[model samples]
Target: MTTVPAVSPAPSAAPAAGSPAEAAAPRRRRFPAWLAVVPLLAFTALSFGVPALAMLNGAFTAKDPSGGASHYTTANMTASLGGAYLTALTGSVKLSAVSAVIAAVLGLLLGQAVVTSRHQTLREAVLTASGVLANFGGVPLAFAFVATLGNAGVLTTHLHLADHGWSLYSFWGLVITYLYFLIPLMVLTVVPALDGLRAQWREAAQNNGATTFQYWRHVALPVLTPSLLGGFVLLFGSAFAAYATAAAMVGSSVPLVTLQIADAISGNVLIGQENVALALSLDMVLVAGLVMAVYLPLQRRSARWLD
Candidate 1:
């Protein structure tokens, strides 16, 4: 039998004119990528970089106690490195650490509740209320708590606890107030991390005879640990550097570095020491830096998960 001749394969066509490669090769150079950096450079110079440098300079300079002009010196830095400064800085760090822990724990629980709740309306209401109240910081929150928990507060009178052992001005009271705001913040920051957990893993854990606590302990906590730590660090920074809330709550009775700085700057001190105020601001920076020491690691690790 005669077989038909095999057909020849068609030749491949050339790429279309001005294909991506060709187009990219002859592209006109409009602007360098560095052009995009100008606005950020301007902002950094004007807002953050300049101010930070100024503060750095101020930290080194000693102010004249007799109301004269302050000048640059190493004395301020040297004196600030002494015992009194270390004590205040340490106290600030301790207070911040406590506040961060309280905030993060409360926030984690609140986020879990909001995320897992069956009641949509209730969950929405809680989130809406939390959002509104989250922005309520500083003096406003302090007064809100004071009005309700003060010696003559509504609860105090109603509960017949007029002389409640806890005063609004006490250290524990400050922690509570910091927590009131901190919990909501944690809810906001952590909801995403909690939500990022794959539902299938949870279901798998459950199917494998894992209890709810077991699933969380084994599967969830490990994945979310970085984010949780980051949130805690953020809260620590916020509570550590917070000024107005503590100031409005207790004034100088329990002096914070921020309050101490305010006293010096406003010229309300017995010694009229502006240099000390500058030094305190520097101490605040160190406290923030220490928090970053913890923060940077979690932040770096968290980025890998995002990828």
Candidate 2:
């Protein structure tokens, strides 16, 4: 038997590294990140952007002194920039600032307390209360404040606050009423951020012989500052834009920007003052825009740590 040597199999050609067959890993690519917010953006544009643009356009438009029709003018801007409108703007700023700062401080303490609490039921109860209170604004809130602090209110009548120089119609009274919801809203905002704080970070700080104050100042606070500031900005905006509460509570006694806008639209007997209301709206929107511009960057920074 002639044993012929088995022929070696012919060498097979290997695929090049760049060839599709050799590319086992799928091509690395990313989905459009903005797709996540597209619906939100769409809703905002339709509900917010459209109305805002219309208001902005109307801000410059004026009644034609000659033709008795609408025409472009700058008088609205000039008028809104000074006089009662300016005073109302300043009042709004002062009130919003005071309320926001108070709410921020109180909310931070409340949030931290809830986060550190051992009782889950207590936490849930507090959060539920907060959620309800945060939404409890506008007419109902005003009514509640009136019932509690008004001249004939339970607290006022029973306690005789009037005798003691307390007045619910005053600026300070408005701040107190605003705090009812603002503090709870701040709690809702900051609690989640507080939750984002990892226990390990605290442990790490402690292992390094860090004191409680040192840990909070160096680690916890830096992470928390952005969220605190963002919440404060939101509270400020909410206060600034509020109308129904102030309207139902104090009316024109307080020269708030919201009141000024409402007056310009409804109560003003002056012809062509409707344009001035739109101008006031424009100013408010500008201020809100500036505030949000500041808040957006802080929010982005905070999200990095929290997320």
Candidate 3:
């Protein structure tokens, strides 16, 4: 002890900020993150981007009727904007608007109820059901509805709904059918917004002597408006793009743009309308783009308030 003091070990040095070790560490970490999204990006490119590009190319290019080379032209685009095509477009828009409005209102009410309920199981049940029902459409759904509400359906036969002029092949009937899935979609979209509502806001409103209606009308509605509009836009796009159910249920009787596109592609209505189908698809893309433009802003606004 008297001879010498014990020597202390030196601390280990960290890699320098600009060192290869430090640089390589981040690269190693980032590689996995980037790799994780590669499959998703590839899938999107293959499924959506490629198809979209092909559609755009086909929309503006027309094959010669006299067995000549294909050439770029605007005739298809012009044709899509008028005549029967225009009628189909207008009909689809009207149908989408009507269904979306009705579904938005009803779904908002239902979501509010689910959010306010005290029962956890009931809330889960409703949400689970909504998730399933929201994705339930196309031919199976069409068949289900037809079996339940068609002219010779169980309900029509038992309840005399057909005799009362309740036809499932009509516009109003399609509206009703759309509501089946649209309302559930709205519920899924709005429930998270409802859940974002802070209890303090309600408490503060009550402390300020605000009634339920007053609180909702003045405070809650303003905050929730963006989300409501966003949900409505989603529902509208869903209804507008829907094809299988409309195709299987009412066929050309509905005069939907989607149905028209199918006719153009299959040449059922006219030969050499394939390019026109692409043009109609382009029109739909433009409409969807406009809708998304509106929806994105509303979504951002809602996020600011809710998040």
Candidate 4:
């Protein structure tokens, strides 16, 4: 049996460096990641970028009174930042600040309670409700509040709230109405941060002879400050940009920037003020940009601790 030595199969050759197949391997892996983000980028460009560019063009450009042509000018921006427009902007800021403060405080307390509770079902239920209520705003929310707390509302009539000077269309009333959704939104925003707290930290605080209040005051609050400030900023921005709810609830009584913008757009206050509306929109964008500037840093700081 002089069989020849069996030869093993030869190993396949390695792919050449920079070959098309080798180069294509990385691209194939990256394609899905880019695919996922491309839609988002396209949507943002269409929905936000295009409109923002148009707003900028309109804000600095003025139409001829004789309807002859358009020209670039700063009068619209000037008018947006002065006189009654300034007053409306101020009112909106105040309203947003007040609502955000109240909501942040109350939401913090409520979220803490929910987080510390031992009942899983209760936690899930509260979180689910918060998510729903957080998103439940706009005209429907306005109508619901009006029907429940308006001048001739059922609650107002039965509870005699109207007799006690409880007007739902006043500034304070708008604050109360804003709280309906804002608190829930704060709850949603802060709950994750609350959950990120470590049990070991609390144990360590207690092992150091710290009381519950001392633990939270000295240890937890410092860690949670960024999250709290971030929540406040989110709530403030929400209240500031809100349009339909305030429009429906208080109409011109509140003097919100949003209402003024609407007036300018519709020519309700002055004809040919469409450019002015765009200018007001620009002002709002700047305010929103400032708010986000504060918020993003806080979010990054919080992520260092929580995430």
Give Cα distance to truth, residue 97, candidate 2, Å: 1.2
Summed backbone clashes in each candidate are 0, 0, 0, 0
Give candidate 4's TM-score: 0.86
- Candidate 1 runs further than 4 Å off: 1-28, 63-71, 81-85, 162-164, 270-272, 301-307
Superior by lDDT: candidate 2 or candidate 3: 3
Q: TM-score for all predictions?
A: 0.83, 0.83, 0.86, 0.86
Candidate 4, 159-247: lDDT as tens digits: 99977888999899899999999999999988998898899999999999999999989878878888899888889999999999998
Off by over 4 Å in 3: 1-46, 297-307
Residue-level error in angstroms, candidate 2, position 33: 9.4
lDDT of 4: 0.91
Clashing pairs in 3: none
Q: Per-residue lDDT of 1-307 in model 2, one digit per residue for the tens?
A: 8999999999988878888787886677788998999999999999989998899889999877787787788889899989889999999999999999999999999999999999999999999999999989899999998989998999999988899999999999999999999999999999998998899999999999999999999899889988898899989999999999999999988889899888889866465588899999999989888888988887788667655
Model 4 alpha-carbon drift over 4 Å, by segment: 1-40, 297-307
The residue-by-residue lDDT of candidate 1 on 96-160, one tens digit each, is 88889888888998899889888999778877877777778988887888788877778767886
Regions of candidate 2 where Cα sits further than 4 Å from its true position: 1-43, 298-307
lDDT of 2: 0.91
lDDT of 3 by residue, 168-230 (tens): 998998999999999999999999989988999999999999999999998898789888988
C-alpha positional error of residue 305 in candidate 2 after TM-score superposition, expressed in Å: 5.5
